[model samples]
Target: VGMGDSCAPSNNLPYGTAMEANLIQQLTLRGWAVVVTDYEGLGTPGVHTYTVGPSAGRAVLDAARAATRLPEAGLSADTPVGIMGYSQGGQAGSWAAELQGSYAPELKVKGTATGGVPADLLKVADFNNGSYGAGLVFMAAAGQDAAFPELR
Candidate 1:
């Protein structure tokens, strides 16, 4: 399952509430179960950590763990899994891949597919200067600062 872009207030949009029905249907048809994460605080409380790699990665892994424990889903702890994401989601997926070997060794992650990943926040900041995406760069910086004070 893919992590989505941005966070909407739970009272307004509620995380994962707007997922495309067709996408879920296609995955189910292919015999792949799905579980998407709403990130740290998007569907709950407090501020979302946005691009903080470790936080996003942990959220994805935790979702995987939570999915396996649902008795009705019939998923086991040994179930093999694959992850995919794009844009901001891509970065999160990539981080999940890096973290899984250590953070969640019990999880059987078969593979990860990431697209349009912004791997380097500083590079994104430098490259987007004076460009339309410059605003995104600043937001990334702010998110990093909020999530990790040492980086600030």
Candidate 2:
């Protein structure tokens, strides 16, 4: 939710926090299958690639791919996939859906829904520069640097 490996969803006891746990519980209660990704470097090695589109998006789609391939899950390519998220997750989900046509054409994406996406990074940075959320800008910058080491 914030920065660092400690905050990674995978490292959390109930999937990042109470809110995330509750969301997963709600979906599972309705018999809807859900899979959450920790994204690259999160809880694994190196700094998390926080808001970078391609890395997060590829992780989302790849999660779907991994879920459907699970032998015990019984899910298949025929299963309809739906992506949903808010804020950072929203960005990831939307990117996955956008890239699905080429990156994961085989996934049967039924639909996608997102909210509070930081689509315009410059605007978000400007708006939060002097506010309580200002730290987010620095975190995002570090994430960008992590995602594109060559560019840096």
Candidate 3:
């Protein structure tokens, strides 16, 4: 249910394409409160760095903080939280978990689940050399550029 750069929780797109609606439905079905984030720059004016993990993590965590303050959510300061993501989102989720120890320690991030993590971009580029999946090389380049501007 993790959204990419061009998508946002507030976008009026179809349910399948919007993480907000999907998360809402799932939370309702399970009787849980859902908190959705538009990431750092998706709905705001700025570059939407798709795979910049720290920015993504901060956006997610800050959105949760904002959600907890809403009267409709009825969430308390002591509520437990967990993180999960896939692909680019896996990077963001991992960053969120790592930051939780220092930056939002009260949020109680019990665990995290990530899949298809691009932990080593250089290796990925070598693996996809000269193939159609070589497009991933470009993606890695963009991600690295956003994550480490000095590398750009």
List ranges where model 2 is wrong by over 4 Å: 13-18
Q: Residue 40 CA error for candidate 1 (Å)?
A: 1.5
Q: Across residues 30-143, which tens digit of lDDT does each residue of candidate 1 receive?
A: 988788777775564655677888888888899898888899889999999888877777888999999999999999999999998988777887889999877786667666
- lDDT score at residue 145, model 1, on the 0-100 scale: 70
lDDT per residue as tens, model 2, 1-152: 67777777777846446358888888989999999888887876888888898888999999999999998888987899999989989999989988999999999999999999999999999999999999999989999999888987
Better of 1 and 3 by TM-score: 1
Summarize candidate 3's per-residue lDDT along 1-152 as a digit string, tens digits. Answer: 22244556566444456644565687669977666666665666654566677887887778767777777888887777777777666777888888887787778677898888767767877989999777667655654565577874
Off by over 4 Å in 3: 1-6, 12-16, 19-24, 128-130, 146-152
lDDT of all the models against the reference?
A: 0.76, 0.88, 0.69
Report each candidate's C-alpha RMSD, comma-separated, in the order given.
Answer: 3.8, 1.5, 3.3
My TM-score estimates for the predictions, one after another, are 0.81, 0.94, 0.76
Which candidate leads the pack in TM-score? 2
Alpha-carbon deviation at 124 in model 1, angstroms: 1.5
How well does candidate 2 match the true structure in TM-score terms? 0.94
Candidate 3: C-alpha lDDT: 0.69
